[model samples]
Target: MSSAEAAVPQAQWWHSFYGGLQKMGRSLQLPVAVLPAAGILNRLGQPDVFGKDGLGWNNVAKVFAAAGGALLDSSLGLPMLFCIGVAIGMAKKADGSTALAAVVGFLVYYNVLRAFPEACKAPTVLVGNQCIDYASLKAAAATYQNPGVLGGILIGLMSAWLWVRFHRTKLVDWLGFFNGRRLVPMITALVGMLFACLSVWVWPPIGDGMTSFGQWLSDLGSWGSGIFGVANRALLLVGMHQLLNTFLWFQFGEFTKADGSIVHGDIPRFLAGDPTAGQFTSGFFPIMMFALPAAALAIAHSAKPHRRKEIYGLMTSVALTSFVTGVTEPIEYSFAYVVPALFAVHAVLTGVSMAVTWALGVHAGFTFSAGLIDYVINWGLATKPWLIMPIGLCFAVVYYAMFRFIIIKFNLKTPGREDEDEVEDVTKA
Candidate 1:
């Protein structure tokens, strides 16, 4: 077996780190998995189902849209998903009790954090160097109470570790009530409160940072979107690209409806029938639906003559996955570490795609990843959905040529073209 296949030794630092990241990734599955359904429902709710303008709203669509509201909101669906997913993913025995503790923990964490700025009389920071009055700000901030996905992930990790550590601990006979699963909730609550209190000092700086960066991106305009796109692609290596989206897609600024209703986030605004959604997300469509798939084909074509069959099957499957499902990790990971330079170029091209999408005023947000499925349903709402296809075709050609040229010129070890002695037998697709 290859050294990469060897099991990481127990109780080591790297093992612990790896295990933690794996847990975070696993906890994301339930929440992430549900988004496609939310996207479908939201799209079904939109008036223009067949990609044409002037269709009146459908009753069934409105019902689906209303029902889907529960799932699409970050504070509502995502937190609960984090609670259940983390508890289940992290439990040694997958006990219902662990999940129960997680629920308690999740509620307490956000409640405490939200109450902090209020209890301390911290003024609500607003757009353009203005702050709302502290008394009124308390009510508005309390109403929002969003911690983003990172908070949920952290709470999950903490609660999971606490569950594993103390779930089996024995207490003195007189205090046995606090020893088992029952005790987990109380302890988790206290920990939640502690973090909530800590967040007063911690959360605001982050908000400020996001505001500053958001302003910078806004100032840069189309190029800023492009830069964000590239950064999003590059951050996949560290598995934290969603951090950037939290600001732009969520609450960097407010969106006022034509009827004077207010909303937050790209997806929320889009679902609320806004024409301009998907500022940060739309660019990903061209890259995922066309460019990367073409890159996959190029990888297949460039493989050694003897390995073409295996390469063909693997790349084709991953290409389809990227185009249809909006999941590009399989194709990306195939060459991520092996050909870092090519990945950098991919990031640049992603930036360019985002710039082009924004420049053309084409907008369509997704509840999940950007792909053909979302692009189709959201087409009518988009400014120029037709433009995406032609742009994507162009990007596909660029990616294909780029991949072929770079791989051949540098003798990069991409999948089937890897050195004979270093073949990776496991095919992810």
Candidate 2:
């Protein structure tokens, strides 16, 4: 067999493994993401959105809420979760070393950034007034209570990559223990600290910029949601969606808390399933869970007679995944690389989904994307959980029918609709 053919099985195996890991990560994110939000909301005096109230109605009845608050205060909530999530998601082997490196990197970054002002401290009498209080210093530097889980994830991924790339190289015999996987965490911590130092000293204003940008997006209202939805998908093509999400979801300047505090970090976390917390994510459910799959169905139904069965099987899987998990890359990449026009249509539909959700004021949040899992968590924890199911089903039917009709009418070259020669060559070769 040719190298390409031989490699296909390996690729498939990797894909399966990665897909499973992604699902696991998504599952973990649901609870971890909610905890911080729940805690914050509890502190702010909001009852459980899930309707857990009773006659007693004591503040301490909020078990999740109390746990969430402790997690946030300890700084072990989102940061630690992000480190583990990113490490496992990106690592080639799912090794413990990768996770260790991620954790170390996050700690390093946190300590470095957290300590810069203290490091710069001179005697208070000489400088005027007492040495800056740590909190005041952090606030002045634009570093809030949370630096953001997204930032932690990025650092974790970077650390894991570094470990993978250089684990085998030997530099010193005396420091053998620090080589390979063992050294990943140390390196991560060092690197993070360095970055933190640089952030506080040379580039403090960057935080302000992030905050301003988030605030600007927030101010745009429904139009902002539509723009975010379109831009998010567009950026995904170039691998910049994470950066955008960080700016919007994290950063104190971007969002104000119910208590009027300038809160840093995710809007969803701040609101904890408030239904109004995840304005950006709310719009996505209709599109990913509904519209994309419908498009896929359209393409599948339009396929040539001989290829119809094969195409249906493929599209069926894609549709289910999109509906349940909100991971559209599998379905999208199938057509996007081959049929640019169809992909464009998909993007337009995404924008429409955002606009529709915004118009209806259906707000919900997720750590990952707008999949069924997130829909359930946000909805269940939200004040109005019942609304999601009915709304979601409606979108699903619309998406499937619309997609099917479009594919048949336009003769789009979706998977099953490939030319006869293409199929023959694929099968024969």
Candidate 3:
């Protein structure tokens, strides 16, 4: 094993500190979790109770409904909170400097795309004859929007990196007030904005290329769903899934509403909330919520008798995290390092999950992972949330059983299945 692999056992102070920040970020989601529930309640009955009249009990209900919606949007909106969440969770040191840097990076990314002329212009393919005048294109280009989540995440990563880079820079005396953490965020934000502005000015075609790519992916339909599933898992390794998600969910497609208005946003709105939106997320519910957890259990059961307890503890935490927050790294990494085939199987299962959901039109959405919390939230608010649970549970059982059987039959080198030498050392140690 490499030094990095061995280092995993060290449990460095930085790891603990970062873990604490992640835990805090996780806790922050609880209150935000309430927003989805409230939105569901209002959607179900509030509108009817608050008549369409300008003023009355119905109007009162509308006010409440609107307030709830706004609160949910502001608090839980991925773009609004992604920077803070990521910065806090991923930063080596939990400080205001990192958080502020993330914010700066996000703003830079947003404004850069927003200012891109090509970004504003609608695709000629979509708007054929309507694209007559260059003036219209210019107007449209000026109105282009950014993939907020993508921008935010990039900003957060950049900010964190910048903080680390400048934390020890000399010139502390001359730039005393702007040194350290405070200086990092300030510098990051300024740099990001400047980069964004320059990119827009120098590379108008880049935005157009991205728009084209999004459209191409959108056109893939069921194949697109499968690709997304595979891609999502792959990106998870590098923590870039959020960026892919932004393109697919928000930038690439247009969702038509019941009243004939078209809107652009993330996949969750279309799959779980919007009445007229397509069921884009129908495919993920099964793999994320059920299958992966089952696999975790299977690996646990197959663990060596001596290591079983430790493996079980790890798997249990991973399973709960997967179910609750949809974060699956703990689980994926558990077997991925030791058993490559199992990871491949896991990836295949993910694709299968998406294909099944897409074929059934069982749409769902999640703020985090495809776990139960998001399932419940989306289901409660979705037009067909009930279908997801039944389907997901069935897959979960299959995953667990198959994984268990495979480990025993193949003698897979999963967690807790180390060689005799290691096992002896572990026992002795």
For each candidate, what TM-score against the reference?
Answer: 0.80, 0.69, 0.66
Report residue 365 deviation for candidate 3 (angstroms): 0.7
TM-score of 1: 0.80
Which should have the higher TM-score, number 1 or number 3?
Answer: 1
lDDT of 3 by residue, 241-311 (tens): 55466555543455554433334544435532465333345667777667778888888888888788988
User: Candidate 2, clashing residue pairs?
Assistant: 37-269, 275-363, 294-399, 294-400, 298-403, 298-404
Model 2 misplaced stretches (Cα beyond 4 Å):
1-76, 83-95, 116-146, 161-188, 238-240, 250-267, 270-276, 380-405, 424-429
**Could you tell which candidate, 2 or 3, scores higher by TM-score?**
2
lDDT of each: 0.75, 0.62, 0.61
TM-score of 2: 0.69
Identify the candidate with maximal lDDT: 1
Put the candidates in lDDT order, highest first: 1, 2, 3
- Which residue pairs in candidate 1 have backbone atoms (N, alpha carbon, C) closer than 3 angstroms, thus clashing? none
Q: Candidate 2: what lDDT? A: 0.62
Ranking by TM-score: 1, 2, 3
Q: Write the per-residue lDDT of candidate 1 for residues 1-429, one digit (tens) a residue.
A: 655555445347686786666555555665667767877776676556622333554666567766666666555565566556767776677688788777788788877665544332355554322335656553232233345555666677678888888888889999988887778888989998887677666776776787687778867868988999999889787665655565576555556644444566667677667776667877888999999999999999999999999899999999999998799999998998888898999999999999999888888777678887878777766777888899999999999999999988988888888787687557655
